[model samples]
Target: MKISLKKTDLFVGIYLLSAVMFFIISIPSWLLDFLLAFNLSVALIVLFNALFAKEVLDMASYPTILLFTTIFRIGLNVSSTKLILRDGDAGKVVLTFGQFVGGGNLVIGIIIFIIIIIIQFIVINKGSERVAEVTARFTLDAMAGKQMAIDSDLNTGAITDKEAAEKRKKLQQENAFFGSMDGATKYVKGDATAGLIITGINLVGGIVMGMLYSGLTVNEALNKYTILTIGDGLSSQIPSLLISLATGILVTKASSDGELGDEIVGQLFSIDKVLMMVGAALVVMGLFTPLPNYIYIPLGIALIVVGRRLKKRTGVEAIEEEVEESEAEAQEIRKPENVVNLLNVDPIELEFGYGIIPLADVNQGGDLLDRVVMIRRQVALELGAVVPIIRLRDNIQLNPNQYIIKIKGIQVSDGEILFDHYMAMNPGYVEEEITGIPTFEPSFHLPAIWITESQRERAESLGYTVVDPPSIIATHLTEIIRQHISELLTRQDVSNLINNIKDNNQALIDELVPKLLGIGEIQKVLQNLLSEGISIRDLVTIFETLADHASVTRDTDILTEYVRQSLKRAISGKYFPSNETTSVVTLDPNIEQEIMSSVKNTEQGSYLSLDPERTKKIMASTGSELKKLEDMGKNPIVITSPIVRLYFKKLAVDYYKDIIVISYNEVESNVELQSVGMVTA
Candidate 1:
């Protein structure tokens, strides 16, 4: 969720108050101080526990940790710097502030903090691996399969106008409530106000408790005002606003759910009045707090107020009421419960969890046994549990992208085991057992090719197993990889990869230049395929996998040539046909005079012959010109017509012999027309 100004203001307010409370409490003596520290430690323990239990770690606390360290060091500097006035103590050695805290020190601290923040960011950005696992484990009522109902508008039914209105109201409510939770969690987690509250409560409470415990009168405890003031003064220096903001920012950004509440608090409490009140309180308490116990009571109360204020301001209760109304409306829309019987769909409940496969001796033969053993060992070592291997098969064709293999196993762990040797066993086993396996079944026969040590190792390390015997699995694997590689190796993007190789090795030009020159046909095929709506990303992925596999040890030039030839063949066969019928123009002289009359132009004294059918068309067209003249003259002035006159004056007067225009094709060029024209009366 994007943070709104309202949220930011609330955060600022809560932070200010929390900061004051926290700082003030730190100055006072308190019984809960140790408990609070323990709680913080327990929280850390929980977070670390999650790291192992979760597929993805929640990294939000890391930044807070660094920020806390920095602020904590700065806030308590005065108390730390004060030297003890012990009897016979050596004279104090005066030192410059730079010696204790200089520009270099600040720079170093910032860099450390930045590094911690970045590490946490990377850790958190990886999507919740734990969500899937936790959902499976904790959400026992919910099944682990995706909802696959196909929604048709008519059958699914649309929401009623009433429901829609209710939904709007509910959404507004949840947004507000969730926002309130956001600010409250931040204040409670780690801010100076929390500390100040602890300090004030602890101070007053401690004085009371100490008086009770030591049998000192209340007046005696009151006499230690100077000491209390000193402690409060030290506490006041701790910036409650800065600490709260830092913590809130960390929690907001780090939580799996976006920190809506943090933003809300930051916005609400950021006003000058709130800051002034909180700041003044922190400064006063920190300087005056003698006993720590009194600080916490006030700090806790302040937090309760901060939280309550945000909740009230945001109107979360109203929102919840509104949401309840909406949900009720939605319930009315859903059809009354109906028992729909399903056939041939006995679903098995599968529990899924991340298994960390420890590396065995990679030098072991990259075989099925070795791979399975490696996976088993790794799982055991990581979880401090032994897992039973359900079954193992070899030569299975899995996804080309990841050497995915289905391993049916259960984790049983309460002890530590070694994993280093497990990884080492995969490559060695691949060479011995996996490569030369023979055909397993009638339907699953396949081919075997040279497998790179790295490829074998990668396959084994990932616990990939062939589901079928060697021969049968080989064919399936080949077909799968072939389909993917064929699509990928023939793409336009491949040209970019080619360019990179070409710059370093001009030999590529000699290798693939012919293929490059003749890529137009292949490009045409790809376009046709694209037009047919084949997925481009799928094509790219297949090619990228092929390229990655090739990177294992294949000759770059040879692979390039191979891809080019394959593409050339696919293009030639798929789109362009070599033996296609050539279109030709043909003319029948028998209907020439009749056809010529249609054009309204036919005046011919002689005809010419030309090679091929094309020349015949030209000659036939000329004869039509004479017919055109005959048609145009209503009086039938056959001798006086311009076309007839031109033909007779130009051809009949001069060279009575016929001329034939013969060109490339074997069509006769007016030869038959000339023969007829010369014999004409």
Candidate 2:
């Protein structure tokens, strides 16, 4: 049989042995030497680990290790105290520490011991405790915001579910680790306090034992026992000080890719100019002031040499990197695969000029990526579809402040933004004018001015809507997405929607998809719905309606009208309050009869073949009625017969793109309708 032991078993055995050592009345000299050496080794190991660990969680067992090591130190203190009181000498470790560390003076030894205690108790331990407390509080406070960011990323498809779960787990562990460190600092404080008390007892008890039992004179007792007590105090307090320093380093360290030493070297000396300037200043001071030439002159010369070397090395590295990149690009251009790769294009792309780069760079405090993630989530909820990831890059050919938004390789919208200025838009009622650079708001084309950041408060007080540059871009992107969503829905997007519902509605999918309509046909219907800003979130009702109507007619437009009638309540609620009366424009009786007669049906599709003059007259009348509704601050909706609704919409789309045209069959009977005006020809 083989006997096996795990790390946990070894740790438990060590802890039990330490606990047993505390109760032993006396430890042999060899054992005393071993314990002292072991204590010093543990303290050094902890100190180095704290300094070199790349991540705080890498030392997740630090608090537990701190507790056990503290106990082991205390146990060693007890055993040493016993040896010193029983015999005139403890062990060679104690005696050697007394003479060498104290320089053969009891007062010097005591003062040194007290200084260590003060430094540990007042400075290192206290600072570590406070840092751990603040870190724990801040981590807990920001937990909600961090979790929201993770959720937004997940919903936007920026991260997979497993990656999100891992991030959340790490967040939880950070909170727990900081909380534990806060409590662990208390142990260090107690250990320091115990060291002070134990040192005092050893001094007094040793003196008493030397006079009463060991038959030594007063002078002899004072000399002998005071050195022994100070020695014992120094031995224990040195390790205590090391451990306290380690705790301070651990608590104060920030998140970084490398160890503390590497971070300090990289960041502190990254700038050669700063070193050169300091070196020059030091040389000047040494020559003018009373400072010794041996001190400042040598140091200044060394610094100057190092600065020049660093500058030279950095320049060489940059040139080498550029050369390598150029060669790689040249090679890539010759490859056949490179030409093939150019055939693919992003569904949506955002290109900005040089000055706008900071708005998307993470290191410059830009949150455009985060804003884009949030936009995707918002679009999903409102439009009932997941948007593809938007590719962003810089284009040098454009003006520095200009940005262009493109959909499927076609430019949809372009705008310019001032990076350091706030845009204040007139809300149509401000009496006083503010002086600034005049511009128009990109999203709605309203009159706006780019003002300094300091003017934000005054602009808000004047009832103007103030927006930042990133917000301007985000708003423009939102509007462009809403306008061009029809072009963005692809066959793959439709397939993703199907896969999402296949588990619960597999039978419905199998019956409707491919049997009644293929994916491409379904995609077209969805595009039609999205083009008019209709949500396809209710896909179950849509597919069922299609199943009922597909057998009767294979025409997508005719089938779409049937689907719209089935979604009458949703359509009505979008335009008006639920169960509330809506005011709308209606065509004149004669005009409706003429439009009905001119409709031409063919094998391909249906279209209006009205004379050009008659078409112009109908459009002119509709425009006039729309203007009247706008003057009353009302959005006008045109209600027409179901047969002419699509044809009328096709005619009005060019000039009245903002107006909504719905069929009578698409309005629910529960909704009350009032006629606001009439369109006559």
Candidate 3:
């Protein structure tokens, strides 16, 4: 049998096992010296690793390393203390360190040992402990916000699921790593205190042993034991100091893109002007003050030379970079595939100017992006439309406060707003007046006043509808979306909606989709409903109704009418108030007959074919009735016979693009309708 042990595993096992072995069994001085040297090398390696790592999590097991190394160092201290007390010699490593550092002087070695203890214990270890504590606390607190940012990016398609998963994993590891470090810092603190206590014990116990067993004089024993204790102290404390310094550096290091040395040099000397100013100041100090002219003048001149060279190098690099960038851009534009990328346009875009950027920027406490997200949800719920991702960007050409909304890359509407002002509009009942800047509400084109924050309370108290800039923008955006939603509905959108239904109600989709009507036809029917601001959330009912009627007539217009009649409840709820009589206009019977008679049937579908003179008279009468309804403060609704409803709607769309033309069958029995006027030709 062959044992195949990995080097890392075997090394770690021996290391940990040796820590225990030092406590259990006695080791010779040669092995102790070798272990002491190995310990120093490991400590140096840890310090270098911590210094160069770009991210703290790159050494996620640092806390565990601290634990294992502290234990091993303590074991070495115990073994060395035993050797000094029992045998008057620890090792050549400890003896040489004490003699070389002390220069064969007793007091200097002790003083040096104490100074090391003070610096490590008071400065590095204590500061590292606090930093680790704060870092762990902050990491735990920020986890939620970071996770939300990841989710927001995922929703916006800014990052993939894989990237998000990796971010989440890194976040979790950061949390655990810092938490472990918070506790691990305590080990280093205790190790320092333990080293101090064990050094005292070795000094006192060595003096007693030397006097009684070696028959040395009190002075000889004191000098001999003191030197050995200081040696042992220096040997152990030096490594401990290095370990604490590593901990301090690791915890205090801010995240950077490169090694510690490189980042430090790049940032400290990046500004040539600062360097030149410092060099000039040093020269002045060297000449005018008591500071050494030999050292300062040469160093100052060297810095000045380096500054000039760096400045020239930086200027050359900037010019070269600019030239490279322009050439690369020209090459990119000439590429056929890259040119094609420029032609693609966003479906919906909200582009503003520089002045409005703060309102759209989340870091500046702007909720416009959040409000936009909510608008998508609101539209989906109310109109059953999957709104495309809305693109937001700043335009330099427009006025500072002006914003433009674009649909399929065409500018449709725009509005200007004041940042810190409120828009106050009287909802028809406010008798009180307030001093404010006069404006018009962009959404409804109603007269409004831009009032200061101070006047917002009084405006609301006076029964005026007070809104902020963000609400004004959101409302305008919602209205624009509602008006163009029909055109925005695409075949892909219809397919997604169909697939939603197919998830649970596959039978209805399979029957109505391709068997009776294709996706394009279904899209038209849905668009017809959306065009009139009808909710299509009830896809099951709509698809079932389509299946029942699609077999009879494949014409989308007639099929839309059938679907509308099937959704009478929703239609009535949307257009007419429940348990209330709504005043509307009724199409005259003569005009309804004329509309049906002139309907022209083609292979594709049926359309109204009334002559110009007759069509003019019909539109005039329809406009007159709509005027009467508007004057009476009623919605401009026209009720017609089910057969003529579709034709009349198509004919009047040119004149009243937002006209509500419904058939008698499209009204539920619960809806109370009062005919206040008539449309006659």
Q: What is the C-alpha RMSD of each candidate to the true structure, in Å?
A: 27.6, 7.6, 7.2
Q: For residues 1-681, could you state the per-residue lDDT of candidate 2 as single tens digits? A: 999999989987976687576667677767887788878888999999999988888888889889988888898889888888888777888877777787988778777878888899999999999999999999999998798777656644568779989999999999899999989999999999998899889888998999999999889998998888887888888988999999999888898888899999999898889888888888887888999977898788788888999999999999999999999999888766756758877778889999999998766988887888778878899888888777777899989999999898888889999989999988888877788899999888888999998999998898888999999998899888888888899999999998888898988898888898999878888888888888888888888888888888877888788888888888988986776677889978788788878988898877878999988999999999998778867777899988778778888888788888899999877888888889998
| 602: Cα error in model 3, Å | 17
Rank ordering of all candidates by lDDT, starting from the highest: 3, 2, 1
lDDT of candidate 1 vs native? 0.33
lDDT by residue (tens digit), candidate 3, 1-681? 998999999999999999989998888888889999999999999999999999898789999999999999999998988888888988899899889999988888888889999998999999999999999999899998788676556544577669989999999998999999999999999999999999999988998999999999999999988988898988888998999988998888887778898999999998888888888889999999999999998888888888998999999999999999999999988867856768987778888888888887779988787778778899999988988777777899989889999999999999999989999998888898999999999988999999999999989999999999989998999999999999999999898888877979977777876889999999999999898888899988888988998888888888888889989999988899987899889998988888888988999888778999999998998899899888877788999999988888889999987689988999998788888789988
lDDT of each: 0.33, 0.86, 0.89
**Which numbered prediction scores highest in TM-score against the true structure?**
3
| TM-score of model 1 vs. true structure | 0.22
TM-score of each: 0.22, 0.64, 0.67
- Candidate 1 lDDT, 567-637, residue by residue in tens: 33332332223454222222233333323333332242233222335434544444454444335421111
Q: What's the C-alpha lDDT at position 237 in model 3? A: 88
Point out the worst 10-residue segment of candidate 1 by lDDT. 146-155
Q: Which residue pairs in model 2 clash with each other?
A: none
